[model samples]
Target: MRYTFLLYSDRADSAQMTPEDWAREKEVYGAYIGALQEAGVFIDTDWLHPAETATTITRKHGEMRVQDGPFAETKETLGGFFAIDVPDLDAALAWAEKCPAAKTGRVEIRASAMGDD
Candidate 1:
């Protein structure tokens, strides 16, 4: 099965990190990605720009509306995602738990609805 791990964190918290801390954080994520690749389960991964750069679109009453920033206001915003192929929910959960974001933020694991597309 394929699962996507959605990473969420507060941009404000990241902005407060020291340069050294940021570097270390990147190093940790690199190591984690390396592990996933070594396990041959890494499909794709990417980091998103801050939510402030996001654009939201919606349709209501047959009218299209465009708005700036995220749709919902929250302390944590989606920061990145990892797509991996694993055997089952247990495997996915195991991988998710190892993600760096899981420690400081949220890691939402979702199985692919379209299968291996």
Candidate 2:
């Protein structure tokens, strides 16, 4: 099965980290992804730019509306995601726990929707 790992973190708190810390964190995450790829389970992954760069589109009073930023303001913002194929939920959780974001933030593990693309 394939699982989606949603990484969420506080952008403000992350921005406060030292330059060295940031660089090291990036390196560590890169290595983790590389390991997943080597294992042949990595489907796709990407990091979002930032909440400030996001645009929200939704229905307002039965009319389509467009707005700036995410739908809701919260302490944690979704920063990235990893889609990996694994044996079961246990394996997916294992990988999610390995995510660096799981340390300071959160990693939401959810099975991919069942349907034809």
Candidate 3:
């Protein structure tokens, strides 16, 4: 089965980290990605730009409405995601545990919809 891991974190808090801390965090993530690739569990992954760069679009009364930033305000913001093929939820959770965001933020692990196949 394939699982989608949605990583979320507080951009404001993360921005406060020192350069050294940021480098260390990136090193951890790089190691995790290397491990995943070696195990052939990595499908795809990417980091998103800050929410400030995001644009929201909606349809209101048959008209297109455009706005800035994410649709909602919250302490946590969507940071990145990874799609991985694993044997079961346990395996997926194991991988999720290694995700950097899991330390101070959140990692939402969900199985892909069957209809998506």
Candidate 4:
């Protein structure tokens, strides 16, 4: 089955990263991705721009409403995601725990809907 990992983090933590620190962070995550590929479970992954660049849209009373930033504000913001296929929730959870972001943030694991293919 395929699962989606909605990664979230405190934006402030990222801002504190030095150039070298950021580079090392990428290297660490790259290894994790590599591991997934070796295990034949990797599908896709990516990083997202800060929430400042986000545009939120909603429908209210038959009209579309737009907001300039994220729909809500919190210490933790949506960072990125990973989509992978694994045999079961336990396997997906293992991958989620291995993600570097999980050290300081969260990886929300969700099974893909049956028709997503």
- Candidate 4 lDDT over 18-89, as tens digits, reads 999989998999999999999999999989999989999988778999999998888899899999999999
Question: What is the TM-score of candidate 2?
Answer: 0.90
- Pitting candidate 1 against candidate 2, the one with the higher lDDT is 1
Better of 2 and 3 by lDDT: 3
Query: Each model's TM-score?
Result: 0.92, 0.90, 0.90, 0.93
| Candidate 3 C-alpha lDDT tens digits along 1-117 | 999999999988788899999889888889989999999999999989987789999886899999998899888899899999999999999999988889989999999997784
Show where candidate 3 strays beyond 4 Å: 114-117
Off by over 4 Å in 1: none
Q: Lowest-scoring 10 consecutive residues by lDDT in candidate 3?
A: 8-17
Give candidate 1's root-mean-square deviation (CA, Å). 1.9
Over 1-117, each residue of candidate 1 has an lDDT whose tens digit, in order, gives: 999999999888788889999899999999999999999999999999999899998887688999999999999999999999999999999999999999999999999999465
Worst 10 residues of 4 by lDDT: 10-19
- lDDT measured at residue 107 in model 3 versus the true structure, 0 to 100: 99
How many clashing residue pairs appear in each of the predictions shown?
0, 0, 0, 0
Query: Could you give the candidate ranking by lDDT, starting with the highest?
Result: 1, 4, 3, 2
lDDT of each: 0.95, 0.91, 0.92, 0.93
lDDT (10s digit) by residue, model 2, range 9-90:
9998777789899799889999999989998899999999988789999786899999898889988999999999999999
Clashes in candidate 2: how many? 0
Candidate 2 yields a Cα-based lDDT of 0.91
